[model samples]
Target chain A: MFSQAKHSSGSGKTREIKEWVRKFASVPEDFAILVTELKCTEPGCPPLETIVALLGSENRKYQQKVHLSIEQIGEIDAKKISEQLQRQLENKEESVERHNEH
Target chain B: MSTSNNKVPVTVLTGFLGSGKTTLLNRILTENHGKRIAVIENEFGEIGIDNALVVSAEEEIFEMNNGCICCTVRGDLIRILGNLMKRRDKFDYILVETTGLADPAPVAQTFFVDDEIQDALELDGIVTLVDTKHVLMHLDSSSECKEQVAFADVILLNKTDLVSEAEIDQLEIRIRSMNAMAKIYRTKDAAIDMESILNIKGFDLEHALAVKPTFLQPDYPFEWAGVFEIDNSHLKITLSEGPDPSMSVSLLNIGEASAEDVTALLDQAVKTFSDKNISLSPGGSIDSTGKLYKLELAQTGSKTFYVKPKKAGKYVLFTQHKPEEFSMTIERNEIEIDAIFSTNYEASHTHDSEVSSVGITSPGDLDEKKFNEWLSKLLREQGTDIFRMKGVLSLAGKSERFVFQGVHMLFDGRPDKPWADEERSNQIVFIGRNLNRKMLVEGFQSCLKKNRQLSIR
Candidate 1:
């Protein structure tokens, strides 16, 4: 009975996506992974956004948002988000290296 | 930075509602002290009600009104103090009067924690006034009252005229149990000797130790403490569980000692751990059996350390610091090493669980390089959680006592008077949240002069 209910809710999908994104993005193991659904009422604001925030070392935060609800998030969305996070991290590392070079 | 002689003494005045704080402040301000005093008051209503001497502290208090005065108002106090220093000639002393419900830790912390403030101002003492008639009720109903009492250097038990002598005696005993160090004086309408409150170096290590011999002994329960005998020439120590991610592990070479000898050494180590006058001298050198193993991340999962005894005799490994997070176990090769000596208990009562104090006292001189490295890392990772820390240390190759104190990340220390007739000891106290006592105690132990006799070669 529990197995059938679990399969219907896609319970394990979020965990798999998170793990995949975390590995792809090369996020630190200690960083907190927060998947939050943000709602906004203002015009031009995304009515619903799913925010994947990586609370990293030194209080640094890296976030990627999808203009969709948490339930609507899927593997493709995770890949996009992870790519964005990887790009941001690469940029940050390059900037830090540039700072050190001087 | 101003010289110690030129630094003006600052006194923090605190009390509960109607505790005769104003009465005491008025006395200090209006008295013929032959020195000018700048008074900063954090009052709810009109500012200058006490007397013409009251300087408006509205800007300071309003800036900090986000709720907690100690943390939020600290910046404002620093600014005000810096401004006050510009007119240093106008006043020889500074007095800050906190609200009735204020926690004096942050205010007391200001003097010890700020570099700029530490330069121009020396925290004279914290004077807490208690209304004898209503203090018991306030203490029962309010945690602030208890904290004010706990951080007091001088507690003036005012309004003794309202309560009977027996009541005053009972109140004094109760207050003493909460804080055994503070000097409690019975007074009528907050009247006391001028000499008692002024020029009292309550924060000074020498004076603090003289007043309360056990001031460094905090009543915090050890999260984990154990003694393990290592007989293997090659061994690995793994921490599978503990309060925090880091733990302080001390490896003392007992040589081919008896069980009785081991017990004696453990007792001595525990005493050294508790005594503010002593620190554990670091252990003898150990040969590495494998690649160097780092002892970090032990709090979340497991951390390991590889040990190769230079000569197999008997090595005593123990963890005596309090765990800031969870309970932990030390394992050898995945096998749980039974603690030859251990303490497993829980705290029965706490005044403020969010903020606790841990005191570590050792009797030996420290390895300056190792001590600095360990402290820098500890403060870097855990400084925000560690609100205030102060210590008097005996450093290797130095006869003068090194007295160091810090607030979070800002730290300062200097050579105090040369070790006179008194024994040179390392006495340190840390007040913070989620502090790992075992880790701290062990880290400090690791910095001790590694068996000076062995190192001499």
Candidate 2:
């Protein structure tokens, strides 16, 4: 059965996840969050995983992936992924500053 | 290269108002295809789709926060499709039905910009439906309608019974002028083979570049051309109003009377159409040997205009409409004479004069670095105007073909399957606004290795 559980177009779980990413990551409204599950079918490829990426308004992207499906992903997973993505953004900015200093 | 073996094939249905997109959707859903098909409907926000797994969503367009103005997409599509992938086992095929008058570029860009969508779903094709009776009006004033036609891979000119056979022919000619590549299917009530529209694999470069020879062929302004042996004496051209009040035409002294000569002048004669029209009343004398002229036959029945050739040898007289439309005739003295060589040409009518298709197919290998530089610069300056472009290119010294496609600025390309036996060539078409054919062809020519055999339209 299709999950017709209290849906408002795209305002359902996808929005919830995006909001979660925004809240936990402490990112601005302009940052674009892309969430998808990439299922690996070939050898040496990453396994079935959930990817959450933050695309900045000024053309910056920081992404994080975990070995879990959407159904298995909880608040803790969202928090950890957001923290990792935030760290990546911070590291990129710090590196840019260091390059500018040089 | 991404594998399409497992990704769900998505077909986007775009159409004008009352083009029967919903009817076709209902029919597809009712058909027992032994496959699970997911329906994404925005049929006026929400449609009553039953049994089939349906998602009622609005068109949410999100501009990619990047600095590029043209980089926008249907945020609703990303969200809906992203959620659908979570339940990937529920459907085998996905159908996205967009409302009429919606800009299809953003919807198309959704698939292009999102990497995961590209991995999970194969953008099978964009299918556009057109109501034969009413499409002309929309095509005339609606930019969105023109974009739908320009971006379509499969165009269904549906509801043929409502319009006459001649009207349908006119519509087909008009649509063909806009898009030289889409497979057009005419049906009464959107009745078409599922195989024809679904799983068309239209985005596949190899299939996309196999453009027919008629693609780059120049569309002449005249609907009918007649080569007649004439002298310095004046010839009487007579016409009667049939449907339209007045008819516009152009005449050329075209030294030779052969069809090949006329064919060669097809590209040359197109410029005459752009000039201001000179109106002639009944029994008016005019010099039409090299210029475009109009016959003003309003309520005045059976008007006659005299054509005095600057010089007399062999001249080709081109008519705007088919000669039979008004029972037109050329008279030398008192007798109505026939043309020695005459043929009817298809009228290439563009609804939006600014937007057009430029098709270039040449037989040569391109300098890879030169081509990359030229294309990058071209897209950088004019990417906002470029709606969509697809091609299969031949790079010099490379055994495999360079297959590529683009939406606005974002492009994806790779060295595709090697050319084992087939002759390598370059075939590309850009559907966009204010595209300079000469500039595109010449730029593409600069990148060619041998610089031999370049043809464009």
Candidate 3:
């Protein structure tokens, strides 16, 4: 249910990420299932970046949703992650090209 | 806890072949002068102990049971020890001599595991014998050589009469770097005063003073040459370095081959070490000191062979065990490179600090950031002389304490625990490795009593 604009806040994003990172570090065991069984429910969910980050924090804990960059998502091996990121990047490129056309 | 009376001391005698182990044993039994001692010998073959010294033979735990305290403690080293302890009036000390190939950890484990034996016996020392002449050769070819030396408390450099003076000095120096605790003794005919050799407790002996066989100067300066070659498609890589500072190198070959392929090659190699003819050293007589040895791994699948001789001498990593798959040579002050493609693992992360926890407090007003930078540098420097680094640090204004553990540059994970007391200072211990002990102490002291709220990040 999270929006991309809301997740893209400057300092707000930093605080959100820090709070999540601390939570993830404190209760790492909760993140294990999400990392191992990652899937996209909506047609457009953030790419595999969240899964990779979760895998990297196997030593920590997590309690909230995670947003990730394209490069981070590309590093993941999940088919769902790859497909979602490919579609998202393509859509972004199409919008930029449309703006150029106008 | 039950306190038992009269704890018997168990002394372990170990070394590679021709290192004069049996000679030392004979001397101990026949010449600890008049000390009533019980001897336990573990042999690799069926030939048994030299027929000349069997005093009284009985039921052995393994195969051979000759007279002179020779019984295989197969399932029963403890049972035998207990039986001997029952007759304690007959002996003053117990010396268990393991096969040159046998690992002393198991024998040492025996004393720690058994309840009755644990109460009755104390581990005195592990005395390792080294054939001064052949030790370099063993170190060059065998992987087990360094592990043998690593566990030694008293190193007897036997056969001093055979090797040249230069070789003897080189051998002594090589042993020192591997083990700083073992007292080095130079002997021919394996002769030493029985009293001084036996009943000596040898744990926690500092290795700095033992012997500097390789890197004589305190600086421990040396260069390494890595060479990789392919013969008929099998890969072989060799790394050469100094005999001083008793360095041991580990070589790992990551390849795309299958584990089954590597396992087959390793089996062949193990059989080669056990073979009587093609194998230069006797089975189990292999000792690695200040020489070059090789281990090979033809990667099968993703995982590969991870065998490195325990010692830091010369080593070559190969994919096959055949002679054509390997060849090596060594000399003083020069590392020979005769193979072909190799490169160093480029360090991805460099440590940030040159100083350590020993000095955190100085009038210079040093801070947390500076301390962390120095600690990181010590980790990145390959030649940093470190034995063990451990401590608890307080984040500038944070009440929680961060725990640190380090060995060379291999330290990570600074997990924090709640501070127990109001003490604002941190405590860390660094043992061995070339470190400025006084400067380290001062660096740690400077971190104490800081009023500023500094972020640990």
Candidate 4:
């Protein structure tokens, strides 16, 4: 099971970890293995073991989340998922700009 | 050197476009026996050859982590070879299918350049497919085609079912003129004896050299000329081997007009080849397809050209260019040279074969002066046929293995550390045409304490 988690207080280390994940995810089938390797190298990234456990946990929210497919997980159709992520990031940038103006 | 008690041979399958290379590749993969095979298909596209169609099980080593492995040409070929070596335990033999318009030289060069690839996989043989119907045309207009034939250890003249006897004969003659060494087979629908394709090792240098006509012979110097006109592209023409070097230079100077004219000539040749339904290659892009004409200039002013065709048969220039215009002097001794070129002026020596090892021993009983004389004569005579030599030889009772190598006229010597297996016998591999094996055997043997025979069978 794969999921995308958004977190604030992102440092250079966190951004670097994300970029590594993106690069690893570019390859087919080996994405999960590469992601797991990256998590070990990542300074403060979430442990892949924790993610796998969470996906199997007995909580209603976790169970419902398990039902959702990882559209962003390097399936060739991830292009659509990337477009949605792009829109969200753009909106967040606009709001930050407005907050700084105020 | 293919398999040392279990090492599988890696065979490279190469040819021009639509030459039935892939068809032969599929037959080998699907029909072969118990050997666990790995297929490396270098295409202009990303997709691999169809698994169900080419091989039943693509599971062993299909996933190459390198982005360039499955696509492009030599760059991808090296990566694929590297990846295959890493996973060598999975397969018994590796078969690489080069792109239709690919040249075998670069791919063959990969085995020698990368030490890791070289150690893991020995270049077993280069199997080139020539489409019978279009081979002549391809040879006439495609430079890549000429290089392919020149580098082949074995040539599969496939699709012979489609052509007439006369056409095939003309094609064989052209192929031989370009590559005197390659074993040509007239196949029907790409069908070939898989065993014959796989087991082929180094070339029979003596055989190749013998087949090459002597352009150095006196009294054959004659002038001949033909104007090749083209509208759009370059004309790929080949001079048969044994061209007297002086005449070749003069002919090249005449043919060497402006780059635009060369392109126009090629375009017209390709147009004609297409009109005749002969194939022209580096096939896809107009810009990518460049024809290289192979010419042999014997020292006697006699010349021959080898044209790799796209559709028509190969062309040979039998006489000199007796110009209707002004004249140029043709000198003799200047004919002994080998040169290759493109419009960008990157013509250097196109052939890259080298004798990577040598063995030498000076007998205790033989007189030093007499031995030196015999060895010197042998070196000179054998040297004429030697392209690149690099190997170590045992010197009689000495513990050291003498290292020696030469490329064309250049030779060098050094001392190498003694091998653990002294019983392995001192051996040397020579890579060139017309090398006299019996003469070399006798010369080296005469210096031996018990007459050691050096036959590279």
Candidate 5:
């Protein structure tokens, strides 16, 4: 049973994902990026999820999650996540600028 | 308006453990001053026993527990102070006694930063009591002790009976050296005159100006400070080895003089550096009358500023901003020469971990829009680390003086009384952790009116 049990272990993949996210997100050097592999207990929630959170000024957080384990995430998934985060950041900047204008 | 809108003076009493702070509090409460006072005791332990000792006194006593007043209990203080304001009719004065290890900056800043607190109460003064017998050991071991001494407007040397007269004199000298503006009083068992401690108006700019002409000058921390000789020839000043990326560099020429007399002139110039009366030139231009000039780079993070003196004479370079590591050298004829001078005034000693106070006094009207934008962004980013900020400013196109101050992110400012017959100037002090004095000074200089001619040379 122990030999058959499946575990999420992908240090190399995780490192690659983080590097790709950092390069595409263009987050400030001071801003921190936190990646976590969380398991959901709720019946309707995804069984396993990978959350990538970018924390920056004014306690702002940008999070993108994939409903899959770290081991399952590949370059294509990382690219998609980075694009989503970049769009979110651009939207945030636009909203902030508009707010300042008003 | 809230009933607390009426300005009730709040006095912060800070001291080390076994420093007779309680005795002084008790005396203030029991003394027949004919004024009702409220006491807020910030106790350290789980149990609140100090209030029990003061239960017999007629003054209203409020206890704040959980942690030191300077840190975790600051919110508790704000809440209690707000509550006390509701019962303002019962008391005419508010006294806050901080725990032994508390830094008084936050406590004093509470009044300035909070809108409700600012309207309800005025910071009368920070009165720090020092135990004559054991304060030296505490001062050497604890940074809190030094900060308490530094932030004090009035320091009472209590327990004088325990120490000899010679020791008391030595202690007073040391305290004065750290904070020259504070009024020092000798007492035994915290027995001080009620008039000396209460309603002192130490924070009142108008009253303080009346007492000491240069009351707004801030004490800075730096390893070395000196005056250097710079002739009409082009000189390349390189700060390649300083700890910080930049340093506050002021160049002032008090006419033709020898290198031997430069130290004495520099001493006089340092006094004028923080003097609120003397006007400063805009954009670091040479002041024609005072003969003082501040050097600043056009861009940030650039350490070198090529100096071509207008006239051949002696110029003083005073470097006392934050840079704990490395040294400075001046390049003459492509040769790196160690900048040499005479006077070596050792600033107040503190570890790199401690918060330091940096004061900048300029004698030019500030552009209001630029100043507000810069200050707001600064507070938003680093307000938590910056414990206290106070400034009396002279804004362009405004006859009234602008007096503003803050604690953490909360800042308050308003047009104070008219300039009257006094000279218009700006004096600002920032007490915080890891403060970049050079950046702050440069940023403030950038806020001056664009037309350099407006500045009085």
Candidate 6:
């Protein structure tokens, strides 16, 4: 693992986070996972955040964010964020099923 | 690769069913008004044209593995354009009439994806026809309707005679808000000057929308700015409940300042809005110490707030919502004081629009290094959300205006015609989804050589 002091913006941290997202989300290695750093100056928006977009096998796009900057994120942070995204994905699946049943 | 001269221009006609696509197609085909046109239409039976020029379009869409997320291209369009190339002298132009329900992206993507098609054919522009009378119903319900309008380079709001002028104006605002860069031509029965619509070179890196002052007043960061010359004594700004439950106001002191000073203050107020606003109870005091103040209204009846200037000769009060909405009045020493200088600013951001246009036409040369950094960062993160952006910019130290346009993140720009006798100014229009005009203006302002970058920290 690269130095945590080496901001998450570095390629090493991005790759590690991508792996954690795939592992937590239960996706294959070839799955599309993108890590982006966004700085939104607008109020209520964190000064710096990490946006992750993961494409599911079924093609449903899942997007989530860690409030901290990439370098600031740890393995625990990534795991928690990924699990939250996974839960979101499951909730959406349940909602879609509910709609189809009706 | 064939030069632009030989490239057969293809214009995509898209709209909901019965929005006068056939009318416009037949008019262009039969008018004998000049250039030989070959049409690739899926709905062949809709038009009565029984000629060599009319070819049936095969609706075959293939998912592209080119890594451009979900990029789908029409297989039939590639085959058709290839066949048309063999019979070189048959036609100079290609018009593809897309089905009302079809997503226009695939058809557009074909030109960009296919190497041979890109060489021989130019994706001229997409023209969407809007059924003005019934569009509001579809606009609220249909994603297809929204996509068609959002993807257009030009729009024709057809059947205008059926709707009132006020209704047309609202529809125009709705459509214009969706695609700011697209030139909207109001029409009845799809009646349009064929010369004006055809061969416009709209998608060409060089060709762009004429920099007319845009009709995007509602999307301004703030709705109103009332300038007043007040003393250190307490002054009252009373408002009888207006539009929204809450209102945001930024009172900035501009003491004995010039027009340029007020302009700088206006930029300051735009950034002030994004800072944590001090939510005040109805009768809370408003300090003119440069900060955003939000006042809660309605339940407490008429909201009367006091403005205690730090030491004010002249102060500009920027309201998120219009002062006119809340019959607002300012009084000093129980005597009303008329604004020595007053101007209304539109600083309200767009609400209820997934796709909106932001037009910035400001005078001044922009610092090149600053502009490059701001724009590169903007396009890098926001390219997927941004559909099309085009502009003519006045770059610092450049005599000529820089002309540029981009699809998604692919931007192309160059030094164009010099600003000879005319005044040097920058005018740009962005047609995209969830575009923040305040951010765009602030970013652009920060790049300018004249004004200090006061909008962003």
Q: Top model by lDDT, which number? A: 2
Which 10 residues in a row give candidate 6 chain B its minimum summed lDDT? B62-71
* Candidate with best DockQ: 2
Q: All candidates' lDDT scores?
A: 0.59, 0.73, 0.42, 0.42, 0.60, 0.70
Worst 10 residues of 2 chain B by lDDT: B62-71
Q: After aligning candidate 6 to the native by TM-score, how far in Å is the CA of B396 from where it should be?
A: 9.8
Which ranges in model 5 have alpha carbons more than 4 Å from their true place? A1-102, B1-6, B42-89, B103-119, B161-181, B203-355, B420-423, B450-457
CA shift of B114, model 4, Å: 2.5
**Lowest summed-lDDT stretch of 10 residues in model 5 chain B?**
B60-69
TM-score of each: 0.49, 0.65, 0.37, 0.39, 0.51, 0.64
Query: What is candidate 3's lDDT per residue for B1-457, written digit by digit as tens?
Result: 1113355666788888777777787776665265566776664422233532222212222221111111112234544564576677776677777776765544554443223444467666778888887777676566456556655657888888898888786667666645544568898988887655666644211221122122122221112223332222222223222222122232333232344433323323333333332121111211332222332223222111122244433333332222222233422223333434322222212111221212121222235665665564444342134533445555565556555543232232343656665545554444343456545554455444444322110
Largest TM-score belongs to which candidate?
2
lDDT of model 6, residue B294: 86
Better-scoring candidate (DockQ), 5 or 6: 6
Cα lDDT of candidate 4 equals 0.42
Which tens-of-lDDT digit does each residue in A66-94 have in candidate 3? Answer: 24432232222233333332343334321
Interface RMSD of each: 23.3, 14.2, 27.2, 24.4, 24.5, 14.0
lDDT of 1 by residue, B86-128 (tens): 6877878888888888866556655543234455578888899
How far does residue B267 in candidate 6 sit from its true spot (Å)?
A: 3.5
Question: Alpha-carbon error at B215 in model 5, in Å?
Answer: 9.1
lDDT (10s digit) by residue, model 6, range B1-457: 2235678888899998888888889888887666778888874437777773877775666442212223355656665676677787878888899888877777876665333455568888889999999988888888778878888877999999999998888788778768766778999989998866777677665576553425554544787666777776778988887778888888888765456667667657767988898988877998756788888885746778999876757788878877778888889988877666666765433333677777777777888888877776676568667777778888878888788766554454667788888777887777677888679887888888896433221
Greater lDDT among 2 and 6 belongs to: 2
Candidate 1: docking tier:
incorrect
* TM-score of model 5 vs. true structure: 0.51
Residue B62 in model 6: lDDT = 49
Candidate 1 yields a Cα-based lDDT of: 0.59
User: Candidate 2's residue-wise lDDT over B1-457, tens digit each?
Assistant: 2235687888999998799999998878877676688898884734445678998657865553222223566666776787788898888999999999888888877775444566677788899999999998898899899889988888999999999999998788677767767889999899998988888888755565654523534565668888877787778988887667877777776757788888766655666766788887788776755577877878657888887777777877777789889988889888899988888886444334667778888888888888887786676678778877878888889898877777676565767788777778998888888889889988999989885766667
DockQ of each: 0.01, 0.05, 0.01, 0.01, 0.01, 0.02
